[model samples]
Target: MPPGRTVRFSLSLCLLLFSALTGAFAAPVGQAEFERGVAASQRGEHQQAIQAYLQAQRAGFDQPALQYNLGVSYFRLGDYAKAAQQFAQLTRDPQWAALAHYNLGLVARRLDQPDRAADHFEQAYRRSDNARLRALAASALDRLPGTRADAGTTLSATVAAGYDSNVALAPDAETVNLSDNSDLFIEAGAVVNHRLSADSTRARYLFGGLHLRQYLDVSEFDQQSLRLGFNQEQILQRWQLDLRAYLDNIHVDSDRFEQSLNIAANARRTLGGGRDLRLHYQAGLIDGGARYAYLDGWEQRLGIDSLLPTGAGWLRFGYQLELNDRDDLEQNGEFFSYSPTRHSLFARLTLPDAGHWRYTLRGEYRYSDYDDPYRISNGTGTTEVPREDHRYLVGIRAQQRLADRTALFVDYRYIDNDSNITAYDYARHQVMGGIEARY
Candidate 1:
């Protein structure tokens, strides 16, 4: 009785009628061509069905059933022009007009003529006598061009406050006196996206964001960043492609610390049933300043990921291969290269809203192998050996919706790093709560 259930049932009935209608058609006592055409159509030999149907027409069979099957066969064979003509002819028959219009709507959509498709679907919805046909038509009209995929401008803002178990800088193997301090921090960010151009098959956009983070007791560790980017996306049949380029500037203690240019290409394909598979590649050229200059170089990543509908939400999992080629630098008269090849596996699960609340859980594991040996000094001598690291990260976030465009969230993260180098071993915990608003 519910609208959703009614529509689903109608859809199933529609498909069954379309595919099995052959059994309902009666040929004249001597006219076997129509029967042959029906048998061919049921066997999925659409081309052969078309020939047999033409032969039946030549034999004086002018039934609506014959015309409808012809239209379906043409549409399935990608001959939209002929299919449209056939459906147009059937629209003159009172009993078959509604279904004819519905089929015409499908053909129009395949041709990318959304306005025409909407018109046909509306006609089918308004004129049909059968409840099932009317329901199917209404559902089609509701899913017309005015969808969430329409391009437009959007802006959002976020503010959060959190505590970090360790605000200390990341350590090098030789930096034995690294601080392991804790601090309270506040974060604020705003992002905007403006559509540059859009059509049914593609879109271009410009995007930018600014973020700032400050520590209550460690003023010198404050961070800020600005990012600007361009993105283009296109759909070709079943595949969606994306290209992006961005520039990023980062500051520490109000002094410029890093600048980077990043470019990426991505492709995604639907696997049906609310599932998708994606492949992506990204490259970044980074330049570091002052005490962080040794980090200057390039990094690249290749990854594949998939999303599967789980109940009402989704589960995403992926693997990435990373190459970080940083400069070799001398510190205290010892040379070291920070280059590393890394393999990472990650997964995330998002839960559908329960009342006003939603949740997500994510985790990652990474293994890193250094390209060159790291130098270390002992009481009696110095030695060099490649450093290896295994890192684990897990996080959870919960959000409560306050309105259509606003939500409050709490996030928690834990990270543990195990490395052959003693100074690199550490564990950290961070927790944050935030309000986000979008328009």
Candidate 2:
């Protein structure tokens, strides 16, 4: 997800609360209930606030402010259907229409209806009077899976410079000692998306991106990549379906490294309490850059991503199975084939925000096993042995908001890889600081 899109949603929610606090509702008999609801909402008692709001509504209090408060309460209570209904009704009021549609879009996104969400966000963008709110709405619209053909296209770019302690990831102590070199690198990427469909329930888009990276002293490790893709997103009740097909090309050290054509499909279902489940499958045919085509293969993966709430921040986890079938010849003119299975686990702990600074700690582990033996030649002999590897990674990042559309961040990461093969064991550490801006 883009930071601009996420921040826009947060800002819109704050505007909703601000409107509730400043707007007045006229219901002689329900005045007390409305006041109580506002107090309860402020105190984080969303269910109690919902009850009071419902009572006020029952007492004939039907105003934009009342409806907006009720919608926020329902959203906090994880009742998106009721929240959407409440906000949809507020779209008739000229003063509240834009914000109401923005809230509806947020609700639609939570319900896994990306197409409908885009429609609501576009409406909010077109109808908003506040420049900031309009910009936020436009940002949100750009991030939606797909949009109507008449909708505008989005273009974004990022540039960063960092230093790496170990570029090649080689073992520290071995017959062939690992080479360690520190170098500064710069990376940049740009992406553009153009909508191809006009329907809200079913949308399609064409996307293209280019990425390039260069190391100051390690020019041999420089990389460049290009990707062209098409995406289709559909909403069906409580489920969202995403289909993508892409062609990717990569160049390393100014030489063609790899090229592939891939197709993927994913299904996402939103659950209560801000949880979601996603399942995906991808297939690709890869061609390698080597002279003998040793890395040419068919790749396939099946994975699931899940989110669960914790006392503090949410916990996101994912698991995947990958298979690579090599269809090339080895150096000795023998057909090479191997099946590798990998398991990965990850967790992140997001601490409570302190003023303008946000902090996160994350950890990941991965293990891989190879079905066939890999032949390795040392000083004296050559031996074939099944390969196994374990990798552990930990990272910490802190971000400070510089403005509504920009932030500064510093991050540090450590990685350790242990393998049965001595040449593959390595450890690395990296530190980077950068600024991110959105437009």
Candidate 3:
């Protein structure tokens, strides 16, 4: 065999035998044939290895490692179906179950059975104690056509401190109300997922999250938000469909600001070579506080997202159309209706990891056009003009993994808004650092 191929086989077999030989086994009657099979495999004579291993099995010398070696030989010979069968037989052996499942996943993928591949990979990820194998299985699961609920329930939390140049998104320092501040924020979330199909192609999940933010000097800008949601996903061949419903509540300065109910649906299709295309739609109803009742509205959005490979990284692009219709637009001294149509474009680049660090860069642009002109009252009296706004955003983030379940990250973002109305134009910059832990 080629040196590299021999080394690869040796590494895989070593992992397989790590736990398989912990218990006593009877003396093999077919020891000679078994040794011959191992020698044949070392010489890259996979057909000869297969014949020898079969003869050994017939002589009552069956063992987990023997079956594993047989499966590997069949795989090398391009007999994926037989390889899958051999691996399946080892799934009952505790020591080799996860390893068998991992190999079965590879065979399934080669046979063009993505759903089965996902199932096997999920099993391997859930059962394996080897960190490298678990990571490989998880990566395979992510690239497959389905959602895996094998992880069951999970809890996560995050906290960060950051500075914001424009805390209220005001146009400029000369605007009516301008504030720059630093704040601390914390978030906690939980999710529970259950499989709904025996084939592992359908699942339902419940999720909830809470976020709180406190500004050091701006008590009136403190914010809190809560979200509860449910999601269902189904996989069919190369297509995956997701349905979601959620409720959100927001409070600012200890006063209720907004409450909303939202519904969304998405469909994604794999286009080969780690590429994917998705289409989504969302609708929501918004209710506002007394001072912001004029902003109460119904919102609708339709969007598309695509992922493509760019050298060693991935490029993601998205476009969406948004429409908002306010219930009572001419309230609270607002002269014009608060209805608008918006078009948004966003793109992100995720670069390959370098050593322990990973990097991402993103940009977004949005244009909004209102149905009626905006009116503002000033010292000179009332001014009116057709309302239009443009917004640009860019951000970069870097993360380093400190351990298996821990990471540290730093991020920076910039935003610039231009509008025919000065009160709505603004420029801002922000920076933040945070650490995350998972269990």
Candidate 4:
């Protein structure tokens, strides 16, 4: 038999062996727990699924498939530590090994261990045809520090500012329809990282603005946000792991507090040079009225992304399917249930030539529907209605690098979107030119 076919046969036999070794015999609860877990997962109840599957595992359901499912549950529930622990059991079995390694990298990223995360993404990317996962991993390549910072611990602070033309995101009008007023936002933060060892195991924790946008005109439209989070990293040759947590708040246009506290862990593996694949599962609770505006109901996301090698550049792909279901927009109520689904896809290409002018081509699409919002807001008219929106965007960028930390650039972008919610359909055109200087 051919080697590729041989590996497939070996994988199949391994699965058969795993089943026999763990089953000894199937327990009574095996079917019941599996069924319940499946139902919960379908309903987007990850935590409940985790508990149900754990019960099944305790009842002697030891298949690698079951174990992989259990790991998925923990990941969706934002228990990265537990999820990683569960996935560790399946790495020995080729059937799910690649996917498990992919998921491990995502949890590592959530935990803020970049090097380890990158390694895992690389491994998974090489092992699977999931091109999307590979691209997601490659995107992180640019986010990591360069060779200069590779030598020792360093303090890095980042400040980014951009202006978005439409601040209120009102219904049915292009940015051209809205008054010339644009949304202004500024974000700045500092990070302290310490290299734990030679393999570049670094610890990173950041405290900064999640996003801050102030309407140049109205005080009611001003926004101030604060976010605090920490992550620990353990970098490995083929795998990476991270543990993380975050707390955030947003006071937008003087609206009530939009508070969020989330905890998650993710890991990634590298399968090829400059290629990666990853999986991510995160769970979070929103305590505020904003859920009434967006999906507004309690929300959660479970998704995967990959980066793969192409001729000259890499292809990027990601899928984030999220569900929001809450009974009351007031965050306290007995009636009303609104569940909306969101799925996002991303694509981008980076130019290969190392020149003074760097360029990237990128696009993104997002869809969101809110069924009820009242369950999250105070008693009065808080239920968020269900709506679906589709967006398509493409942009090109040009840059001129100059000496003395001075650079010039120009950007042109076009965005088109359509939504059932009267407030969402519109087109945006932007052209900008500027010079940036640093001391």
Candidate 5:
């Protein structure tokens, strides 16, 4: 089908499916009335058919399926709000929530309440099992308000634990190449959002996270970290200003604690499409104090992130220049100074699907260089050099319509790594599959 027609049909199909689920003949109206209504509908007697359907409904025919069909008929009769209302009701049904959420997004979109549409689309994208439909909804979200006035604050958390075959003490330094490894990593996080002005001229967002990791291979390699940060954005029409601060603390089970504080303020240009172009610089100091295995360091970075439209796709391109200066705190004359440059590119696409489904694809490439880097070994007498390398990754995701959830996915990645000191090169490829479920 032509692109133009495809969009039109997608809309119609959503309405039809949602309505059909809510409309059927009412009980006690008798089979005869139902047949008459069908005959009338076939003969273009829509008014008569509607009356018969209502009679059936009034006669106690209120099954869930009947309700859906009635709603569809009403929608076909040009009653959108009624259709929306019906779809909304089905959003709670275990069997119908997926399609219900999709239709709900359409209803909200037609009503000119884009934020509501966005919320529903997000729901649909997260709940649907159809890759194509979820992808479409993800794209739709980008068109909606990235920062809506009434948007609810979001909270997120992650917990990860994996068994490692090899764990080293300063793997970059090749201090010990111990293969017997045991480590567990866990994190918890939360965030809150507040709009500081009626026009959103000023806004503040706050977040915090906690991390704990333990390694068995190194015998006594356990560490914990805590983070606190806040960013305030000042809106100056098309231009934007931001102020940010962060504190990070690291506690080692076998060593004393170390911490870092960083403060940064930056300016950004609105780049349309829920994106921005930013130029930023940051300065910070890391201090291990008098009782640590190594000396502390000074760190600084200059960065630029520009949203660019590439051939057949849109991408975020960014580059960072970093400087690090460290003095040996434990011993004299063991100091190092280094600088590194990093660049990254990311692209994303979301497309519509048949039957309320959607799909999404994203690709990313990143490269980094270090001037004072040394070799890294993988426990088995291998050396790596501090050089330039890149990582390539791609992900494909899908959302289902009938169930209002994401049920499938495909992902792939490739990595090329070279060490500075030992001149070691490591390359890897990976593929993954994932599922999204909603209740």
Candidate 6:
């Protein structure tokens, strides 16, 4: 053979052999890259994992597991749009469809698209054969704004049995004729929200609730309340705003107790860094029942609150101011007034979820100064003095998930009311445990 031909043949043969070797090792290299990506992801190094995953993809490694991991890495990196895109592509596979839809729901929720989130959750719930996944999807659906009860409706129901330390809310030093000062009670409540219309920026709903409490030993203290309302929510500029109007009626011992018409408006603003601020105003016109006509009043309240995210949970704190104007009447030549200006401070802390368990702690303090004097019986004589009240409350609740939309909860509350008038001072403790279901 000629020298030139021999040299060219040898070089070409070597290049062909090298190419064959590279092709033979490509899959292994891709798999190694995928493994590295998974390891980085497990270490919470999402950015590093993303680079390895992209390298694997470039090496022609196309796998469902790889795809899922890549999507999750993107999600962890706060690139929700890219994560959503990756997940959306996997929905074509039967095995991955449920999971992909579930992740898409999470992305939509993070983006504040409730309707889209609900749709995705519902799809996941329907398509999933795995019980745990279905339950998770249902729980996600329950958390959405207007899709709980049924499509376009929100519903929740709870039943509890508890003991009240002071059924009459009477002071310890009072000498009133009462059959029972403490009682065992059972309570049930249901709330419903039905969506009327919705768009990207605004939504409307019809909302209502029913609550009933029965005392085992103190029948006269049994109470029932029914409320019906309408709510409108909208986003304007950087604020989300809500307007609500409702009519509420209360019954005690099977007789009418009080009735009120209420209106409220609230606005929420995101302050970045996982914090939010809310401002609200509420007004009501109250009418007392026949036996308690003197309690008729007009009430107004203004409040501001903030929500702060913690590494392990969240903190919510608020302040409220209340103005009350009630009837000033003279009965049997005795004067009475129920008006007061009240201030309230409240706080709540919600702990991080531990598996399917959740917990919260809350406290509140209130101060009230009466606008008019009350005729009090001191010793053997009646004296008129303006009433001042200080109220304190602390509570805790723990909940355990039982299913997709059901949970068992235990709650405890303590209240202490100190008032200048002895008749209104009281200390009370309540413990309740119950089941709650949402749809």
Q: Which candidate is the best by lDDT?
A: 6
Q: List candidate 3 stretches off by more than 4 Å.
A: 1-148, 173-199, 328-337, 378-381
What overall lDDT goes with each candidate model?
0.77, 0.74, 0.74, 0.59, 0.55, 0.79
Ten contiguous residues with the weakest lDDT in model 4: 1-10
Instruction: Write one digit per residue (lDDT tens) for candidate 1, span 1-439.
Output: 2334533343344346545654566457424786677677667787998898799888887777778778877876779899888888776554566677888888877787655576577667545546566667666655655422333677889999999876763443135333436789999999988889877668898999999999998778799999999999987776779999999999999778789999999998755434568999999999987777888999999999987655435689999999999885777646677788999999998775455577999999999999989877776667886899999999999999766457899999999999898777877889999999876
Question: What are the RMSDs of all candidates, in order?
Answer: 14.1, 10.9, 12.9, 19.7, 12.7, 14.3
Q: Which model scores highest in TM-score?
A: 6
Q: Give the TM-score of candidate 1.
A: 0.66
Write the residue-wise lDDT of candidate 4 on 49-112 in tens digits.
Answer: 7788788878877666667666766766678888887666555444455566666766666676
| Model 5 TM | 0.51
What TM-score, computed on C-alpha atoms, does each candidate reach?
0.66, 0.67, 0.67, 0.52, 0.51, 0.70
Worst 10 residues of 2 by lDDT: 172-181
Q: lDDT score, residue 426, model 5?
A: 46
User: How many steric clashes between backbone atoms does each model show?
Assistant: 0, 0, 1, 69, 56, 2
Q: Using lDDT as the measure, name the better of candidate 2 and candidate 6.
A: 6
Q: Candidate 6, residues 1-439: lDDT per residue as tens digits?
A: 2223322332233234334444554467587787788678767787998999899899988776667778777876679889988888766555566677788887777787666677678767655556566666766776676454236876889999999999888974245567568889999999988999876578899999999999998889899999999999998987789999999999999888789999999998766534678999999999988877876989999999987655546689999999999885666546767888999999998875555567999999999998889876567777898889999999999999776467899999999999988778999999999999877
State the TM-score for model 4.
Answer: 0.52
Error of 1 at 113 (Å): 28
